[model samples]
Target: MGLSYEELMDKQQWLADELTKSIKAEFNKQNIVIANGIGRNRDGALDFSLSISDLDNPDQSPDVELIDFAKAKMKELVPDSDANVVGVPTPKQF
Candidate 1:
């Protein structure tokens, strides 16, 4: 059975918090930020999207290694959770 709405929401928050912690630990020196959101996919499944960016250089995208690390951590953190996790590149903000 799939997770209920409340469970999904909790999972979303948990995933976001964990990802944020992992990134901070791995890139302590850089002023990095993580933007995360929860939404439903076409199939009605809960999906989580995480964006990583650096404030020092907003134009530059996060390194591929960092993205990979987040992806891996997401899998390890919730291997069988009912939420789909996506790592998106942070866009430059004005």
Candidate 2:
């Protein structure tokens, strides 16, 4: 059976919080500024879309690369949870 609504909400919250912290750390390390972000837990995975603007041009596309460390960190933090930072490097994405 699928998870109940309450269970899903709790999982979503936990995943978002954890993922946000990880990504935010990465952004800070790279001096990237985030304008907006959205997180969702679906299909038993945590995913997010973050709008980060470049340090040179805050109004333009920001560097949005989650470091390799972040991926390893997520796995360590949530051994069984499938957490991922989803972003496509393209003009349309920005």
Candidate 3:
């Protein structure tokens, strides 16, 4: 019993929503703003950015938690797909 295309899409959307919630929660708890942008580059590679306002303060930094959340969500959404978390630079050190 394989999942239908629509079912797969729905599952993907659910996973995305779950990830977004986790991201928002972390940002709120850390009193930081996260700017998220998703798109495909000229080379056809999917690019997503998660920008945090502060980076130096451990309590306000979201990098490690974001990476962990992404990794867990990726595994849940696509068990066989290869997904890796890429860290991005923040605007300033807290």
Candidate 4:
């Protein structure tokens, strides 16, 4: 049988908590800023972005390795979750 509403909610909360902890640990280990955001345009299109940077030195932004690390952690926490990144270009030199 499929999960009940309550079961689904509990799973979601658990996933959130797990993801939060994983993210925090990564941030502390790498001393990076994980910038995340979500929004919808007037045309009803959804948009989101996730990026990382060295908190100790804003000029030292994160690279693909860091982004991939975060994405992997997120996927580990929520096996079925999907994340997409659009046109926002990654800094060429981080």
Alpha carbon lDDT of residue 83, candidate 3? 33
Best-to-worst lDDT order: 1, 3, 4, 2
Q: Which candidate number would show the highest lDDT if scored against the true structure?
A: 1
Summarize candidate 2's per-residue lDDT along 66-88 as a digit string, tens digits. 53444565566545544444433
Position 18, candidate 4: lDDT? 52
- Rank ordering of all candidates by TM-score, starting from the highest: 1, 4, 3, 2
TM-score, cand. 1 vs. native: 0.68
Off-target runs (Cα >4 Å) in candidate 1 are: 1-4, 40-44, 81-94
Off-target runs (Cα >4 Å) in candidate 2 are: 1-8, 29-67, 89-94
What TM-score does candidate 2 reach?
Answer: 0.38
Q: Is candidate 2 or candidate 3 better by lDDT?
A: 3
How does each model score on TM-score? 0.68, 0.38, 0.39, 0.44
Misplaced by over 4 Å in model 4 are: 1-30, 39-48, 85-94
Model number with the top TM-score = 1
Cα-based lDDT for every prediction: 0.67, 0.46, 0.50, 0.48
| Candidate 4 clashing pairs, residues 3+ apart or interchain | none
- lDDT, candidate 3, equals 0.50
